[model samples]
Target: MDIRRLKEEIITYSQEIGIDKIGFTTADPFITLKGRLLRQRELNYQSGFEEPDIEKRTDPSLLFDEPASIISIALAYPSKMKTHVRGTKTDRRGIFSRSSWGDDYHIVLRNRLEKLEKFIVERYPDARCKSMVDTGELSDRAVAERAGIGWSGKNCSIITPEFGSYVYLGEMITNIPFEPDTPIEDQCGTCNKCLEACPTGALVQGGQINAKICISYLTQTKDFLPETYRSVIGNRLYGCDTCQMVCPYNKGMDFHFHPEFEPDPELAKPRLKPLLSISNKEFKNTFGKTAGAWRGKKPIQRNAILALGHFKDETAVGELEKVLKHDPRPVIRGTAAWALGKIGGKRVKEILSEALADERDPDVLEELEGALEKLNHETKA
Candidate 1:
């Protein structure tokens, strides 16, 4: 088979299938990524994937014994229509980053990659292919860069000139020995804006991130958020995008027009009152298909309470008080207490006094005391 002809055909096919960029790379990104992962492990930065089997991540040989090439593709999500900012008065409008404003990217990218694989199989009947999005052990950003699609920026995201960092990545691992593209030079010269813009200081020097301090990880984390990072998390209920938002490359990009990514009208900017009151059943029905729905209602509800706390919305105090005692998740209960404290006047103090009588969790008890202290100071004033 003529490799050049195949490369051109692959790129053409990818564009026809709605993929914005495609490039090929030999199955290795560990030259840069391995050190970063090791540092992250050493710093105790990994949130969900603690004890990440570094051998699996660093060695492409482990992913596929015969791995010869990787086809990296980028699909741009809409950016022009500021759906989050549109038609909403509440801060919850700003909760989710624009990347997550639509359907889950994993599903979108996986489906497209499967179709590409079918096309390749028909042409090369003897060849084998496997596709992975963010799920697998492959270093997608490194693959994309090596494939000449775009360079990785200081925020550690692949930055394409057309799609910016708003593009979702998908990869096709194949045994076919395709010609590899040259890795692009880093384009983030002297710009520390992404590092500066990080609310929780998750971004370190040289594009490394500590997941423990990352709002994206914190929102997705199953355990309680660290105390130091709580105040910095702000109103972001899902992933945080301050780094991308502050990047200059993302400017003037057209909004992604895929209907699959369109924001749900009800969820685009949910009212804080309704969000705080949503039942688990209602939460499932409302956001089951959306990206933020994966973690269920508790984290989002907890985040809503945090947003309310930031806004100091007195109206939320009553609801906050009620949830503080009865919410199944201690994280939710703890955040609710914090919100009540921020909005506290008379009712909040009464509720805290009531909670103190039965609250047993050390963390929740500490939060309760902080709430009471704030109320005591307010009352003395």
Candidate 2:
């Protein structure tokens, strides 16, 4: 079998199946990346979400027997919604980052990879392929960068010249010696836009990110969000895109090649108040198919509560009080108390006082006291 011809045929087939960009690289090992992961772990900058085993994450040898090459694919997602949805002063809406706008990218990319795998197997009869999306041990961005899919922008996303940073990445390990593609040169020289624009200063000077403080990571946590980030998080319900939005390369680069990634305006930017009281079934039906729902509805609802507080939507005062008074989860109840304080009204002090009387959880009690302090300060003024 002619390896070069097979690689060419695979590239042609990838395009036919809607893969926006595809690249190949040797599966030797990501030596440089392993060091970064170790340093990040030492500094405690790593989010607990990362695969615990560093060796499995960087060495492709552990992925399969004699892995000769790795194939990386990128699918462009829409940055803007077809029908814009903005929050009204009375009815606030929470925004989900562009990445989570459509059907779960994992499913979409897996389908593409599976199709490519079948095509290669039919031609070579001995093609051994192992495909993985973001959930896998191998870093999607690292693989995509080395495979020449795009340069690693300071925002830590694969910034393809054609698709910008708004792309979903996935890779497949194969036992084929496909010629490696050239990685893109870094184009963000002297561009401090993303670093300066990061609300939480999550981006380190060069390109490293302290995931602990990243708004995107904080939003996905299934507990009370840190107070320092709550205000900066604003109306973001799922992830933060400020870094990508401010990137020079990402400007005027929105591609809608795959309809699967198209955002549903209502779900992607839903009203903040409705989210607080949404039923489990309703949440699943609307957002389950989207990537943002992977952490379940609690985090989204908690973020929505924070968003309502950020907007200071007095109209939501009643709902905030209700959540504070009755939400079973301490995190939700505590966050609600904070929101009530942010959206103070005539009954705000009374509402918090009542919750405090009934609240037993130490964290919730502290939140109650903090809310009362905010209200007392306002009243004294």
Candidate 3:
């Protein structure tokens, strides 16, 4: 079998099947990434969501015997939604970052990889292939960087020349000696836009991100968000795109290559008030297909409440009062008190005092007291 022609065939088929970009690289250990990850762990900068096993992440040989090459594929997602949905002052909306705008890319990319795997298995009966998406042990960005899919950008995204940083990446490790594609030259020379634009300063420098503070990771966290980050989180319900939006390469880059990736404007930027009371069944049915829903509606609802406060939506006051007074989750109730404090009014002060007196949970009571004090101080001034 001619390996050169085989690679070309795979490329052609990938294009036909809706893969935006494909590249191959030798399956050598990612030595540099391991060192960086170790530094991240040492500094307590890691998000804790990543695969904890460092050895499994950097070495493909451990995942599969005699791995020859890694094939990386990228699918560009739309940056700008065609059908815009704006929110009214009374009904403010929160955004699910562009990455979560459509059906989960994990499923979409996995399907494409499975197709690629099938194609290879048919061609070479003995070929051994293992594919991974974002949840996998190996870093998708690292594989894509080595496979020439794109350069690992300053914001820690795989920035393809054709698609910028708004691309979903996946990879397949195989025991096929496919000639490796040349890695892209780092073109982000002297660009400080992403670093400057990061709300939490999560991008420590260049390609290194302290994920612990990244809005994307923070939004997914189940626990109460730190007070410092709450003010900076803005109206983002899931993920954060400030870094990519500020990228020069991402300018005018929007690809609607796959129908599954098309955004439902309502889901992408849903009304914040309606989300606050979204039932479990309703939330599942409406947002189940989107990537943002993976963390369930708790985080989204909490963010929505914060967004209401951020916008100072007086209309959300009653709903927030209900959440503060009666919600089953202590964290949600506590967050409601905080949001009410931000949307300060004499009514909000009264509401916080009432909730504080009635609250039994020590944590919720502490949040309520802080909110009441915040309001009381403002009232006196």
Candidate 4:
């Protein structure tokens, strides 16, 4: 088999299958990424969503036997909603980030990789291939960078000249010795925009991020959000886009090349009040197809409550009161309690005063007391 001919065939087939971009690289250990991972661990900066075994993450040989090359693919997602769903002062909405707007990228990218794998196997039956998306041990960004898919940007995203940073990446490790592509040059010169735009200073330097403080990561956590960063998250329901939004490379970059990436305005920016009481079945039916639904409904519901507070929507007081009094989960109840304080009003104070009398959960009770204290201070002032 002429390896060059096979590589060209793969590239041609990739385009036919609607892959926005594809590249190749040798599967040598990612030496530089290994050091960065170690440093992240030392600083406790990791989001805990990463594959914990560092060795398995950086060494392709460990995942696939005698891996010779890695194939990286990117699919551009729409950066802007073609249709807008405007919000009123009484009925504010919460937003899922652009990455979660359309179909769950994991399912979409995995399907494309599986098709590629089948084509390779049909040609070379003995070929070994291992494919993965974001949840995979090997970092998708690292593989994309090494495969020459894009340059690693100051925001730690692979920013392609064609698609900017609004692309979903996946990779397949194979034993085929395809020639590697050249890595792109870093274009973020003397730009501190992403760092300065971070609400909680989560972007520590140009490329490194402290995920613990990041609104994107914090929104996914089931635990109560840390007090310092709750308000900083603003109305983001799942992820933050400040760093990507501020990048010069990503300016005016919007792609509608694929129908699968089109955003449903209502789901992408759903009404906050209705979300507070969304049934599990309703939540799944509305958002299940999107990437933001992976964490289930609680986190999204909690963030919606936080967003109500961020807007100081007095109309949400009724919904917030119901959550504080009736929600089964302590995290939801506690977060609602905090939000009510932030959106203080006579009704909110009365509801908190009533809930505090009967609230039994130690954590919920504490949150009620804190909310009451803040309300009292406001009344005094």
Whose lDDT is greatest here? Answer: 3
Give the TM-score of each candidate. Answer: 0.93, 0.99, 0.99, 0.98
Q: Across residues 75-175, which tens digit of lDDT does each residue of candidate 3 receive?
A: 99999899999999987988999999889999999999999999998998989899999999999999999999899999999899999999999999999
Candidates' C-alpha lDDT:
0.78, 0.92, 0.93, 0.92
Clashes of each: 4, 0, 0, 0
Each prediction's RMSD to truth: 2.2, 0.9, 0.8, 0.9
Residue-level lDDT of model 2, residues 1-381, one tens digit each, is 999999999999999999989999999889999999999999899989988999999999997999999999999998888898887999889999998988999999999999999999999998899999999999999999999999998888888999899889999999988999999898888888999999999998667999999999999999888788889899899999999999988889888888899999998899989899888999999899999999999999999999898888889988888888878899999999999889887688889999899999999999999999988988899
Model 3 CA lDDT for position 292: 94
Clashing pairs for model 4 are: none
Candidate 1 Cα lDDT to native: 0.78
Ten-residue stretch with the least lDDT total in model 3: 371-380
Query: What overall lDDT, based on C-alpha atoms, would model 3 receive against the true structure?
Result: 0.93
Model 3 RMSD, rounded to 1 decimal: 0.8
By lDDT rank, best first, the candidates go: 3, 4, 2, 1
User: Taking the tens digit of each residue's C-alpha lDDT, what string does model 1 give over 1-381?
Assistant: 777787788889988888888888887546667887877788887775443687776677787868888999888886645543442333334357666777888899898899899888888787788888886777777678888889999898999877788888878889888998887778889989999988888887657888777888787765666667666777677888788888999877655547788776456556666788898899888877777788888778777777788777776676787788887677778878888888778878889989989998888888899989988988899
